[model samples]
Target: MSVFAARVCGFAEGGKRRHQLRREGRLMLNRFLSARSAAVAVAVGLAFAVTAEAKTVDPKTSSIVRGDAAALGFDPAKLDVARAALKADVASGKIAGAYLLVGRHGKVAFQEGFGVQGPGQAAPVSDETIFRIFSMTKPVVSVVAMTLVEEGKLDVDAPVSKYLPEYANLSVWQADGSSVPAAKPMLVRHLMSHTSGLIYGFITPTAPIAKAWAAGGENRNDLTAREYAKVIAKLPLKNEPGTAWNYSRSTDVLGAVVEVAGKKPLDVLVKERVTGPLGMTDTAFFQPEAKRARFAEPAKGDAGVYYDYAKPTPFLSAGGGLSSTTEDYLRFVLMLAGDGEYKGVRILKKETLARMRQDETTPEIRKAGLFFPGPGMGFGLGFSLVNDDTLQRPGNGTFSWWGIAGTEFWVDPKNDVFMVFMVQARELAMEYQRKNRTWIYDALVK
Candidate 1:
């Protein structure tokens, strides 16, 4: 959920400087790093200024430093092979464009951009190309919700009906299509954990509730968050609250909970609480017309989900609607890696973050559905918790998530490592995430 390094020294510095970090006051130690490394690390919680060595953006503050792959304990030539493989995908037009970033010991090793901005477009992808991060937005919203939880403004145990009463009498849909009242109240934690029985239409396209959603126009962009929650509440749920772990609209409902609890719109709450303080300048529900040209495109110009990014919409899909750049999103995850503080700004407390990373589901609940985290992972408050090395993933204590349109990220506090992969090809997301993990983990030779 979040990590902190205090009074540290010589991290991932080859064998030349193997000094141990003093776990003093945790986050306060960030102030003790050497001026240059401290700047790079803070830029990583990263102020995320991508440079030409790795394509940097104009920084609002200190810039993130890219490390030598060999010095960081990665085989430079092997790493090159991995990069070449992805670059080949771009060249073959398998994906529109891509950006990959890997950071370890609070310092990034590389950030690479590939191919054209998208499809047949003339622009090449750069450090600032914005992407539709889709479900990746959930983790951010979950962070924002946790911020409110830290402030004592939101209660994780409280019934969703407490914030949005529309959820109070929600109905559960049976296989035979009959509905019954929920056996338990859907709590705030349920929404964050996607155990609220509110499944996504696309994920449950064959379900009766999914059909109801389609006919009821639940996907309308014109309704506000509260109105959208009302529409969702009226529909029958896929299961009883907390009984199963289904990929859901729960985060979208949590957005309404956040809006009602925080007394503001989802976008405003995110800005004022999370993104603004962390300097995630390019992360938002939509981009301004000025920044529209920087938006990434699909192989087919109009095939991507975001066709109205420049237009106004009353409801921002807190679960699946956000556009961001690698640098901006990197800053946010770096903040998580920094234990909820970035550039000296504290969002959620370290203990709160720890709670979010702890496992929240049983094997029975996970076995109930597709269980997107795969073999070794479990669902946490808002992330996939890596509990074992059973899968070709990171070690235990890694918490991560990804966007539907090929954007994936993971922060491994145990290894002081994290990665961000950005691309606009929806079909390649799962495929690339699986491949990139091997490419990255194999290179972690030290």
Candidate 2:
């Protein structure tokens, strides 16, 4: 039986409880029909109200129906089905444990956890499970940079060398693998859009600099942000800063730059300006001793046991290293959904949020798959732009980013939906997983 099934069996005791179970259970079973049926789309006002309800409603309420789910054009019964499907999938080894939270407008319509924290634990998953949200950290870093932009501390168009003069002399890689002088310097915007010529050491095997990056042995585990920046400064840049699009360690570098500009540690600045104001207490570069027990170990496959990184590293990778819980991340998404406000806690101006969402890439680079795929989608400041079908669902104006360790989150302002799925496994079957996830959304909103 599925986890939901097992849990429900415990709840279906005597008298009125049994009757309630039968009614809700039967309704849930019929959700597949309601999902694909020709019911009219939910009204915009109701959808908004439903999402808002999710933000405020207590989780201890009845499981048969959720107020916000119903308002967002989802049948409560169908939502139950989706929940069951998610549990069934995870239990059967389609994936390891996963925590899902979906909301519309500013409210969360559904929050559920499935499978075990590890193999032998009987305690079911909860909202507090900590996840290593690798690349998702990029968005948070980008938001920090934008916050700096709002404060007039940085400019998107200006050359980064203006702030760090070391970049003033960067050169490009020639066809023969030798360095050549660049006509133009790398700019802050180049780093943001990934049009800057810098390269991520992991992507290319034949490039000499790639080899250097591998052998540099910078001891990322022991270096602080300042130390990492100093190590990177001595390396050769892959290309001229702005001539082409290349995914690089640009965001982490940007984090170092943020440190330089803010005159504080990256973690400290993020805590003060972002997570603190947004109430994401669980998000941090270093896990507190008490919370370390809950950190989900990264795994290579569904059945493979999870493991921590082999090295004892100290550097907190701004591009990829924040650990957070589904609830904490959902709160971040909710703030974005609310136009930068959550329960009157505003971390950014509405206008600044608008800028972050705007497409920042050119047409040529977008077609080259320099960023995410979707119609009308492109890379914005930090998150993947939803401009094409691959990144978008039925809704337009959606954006998200994922971690290497199977954590994904997206915000759809057009549909007023924010969804997060956190897991510990690596190399997920993304297409199949996305199909299943979309099926649930379609069924719920139908």
Residues 316-385 of candidate 2 have per-residue lDDT tens digits of 6777767788777776776677776666555567887777777777776655434434446577777776
Q: Pick the candidate with the highest lDDT.
A: 1
Which runs of model 1 end up more than 4 angstroms from their true locations? 1-59, 301-304, 389-392
Candidate 2 Cα lDDT to native? 0.63
- Per-candidate clashes, comma-separated: 9, 13
- For each candidate in the order shown, give its overall lDDT on alpha carbons: 0.75, 0.63
1-446 in candidate 1: lDDT tens per residue? 00000000001111001111123223433664644466546545432222211221234763366787777767777678778997898878787788888878777887788887766687878768888777788889898888777666889999999999877898888878778888889999988988888877766568677888767666666788789889888888877888789888788889999999888889998886667766678888878999877888877533325445566677777887777888888887887898876665666678888889988888988887668777778888889888886543587889999876678889987777898888877667688888888888888888
TM-score of each: 0.85, 0.77
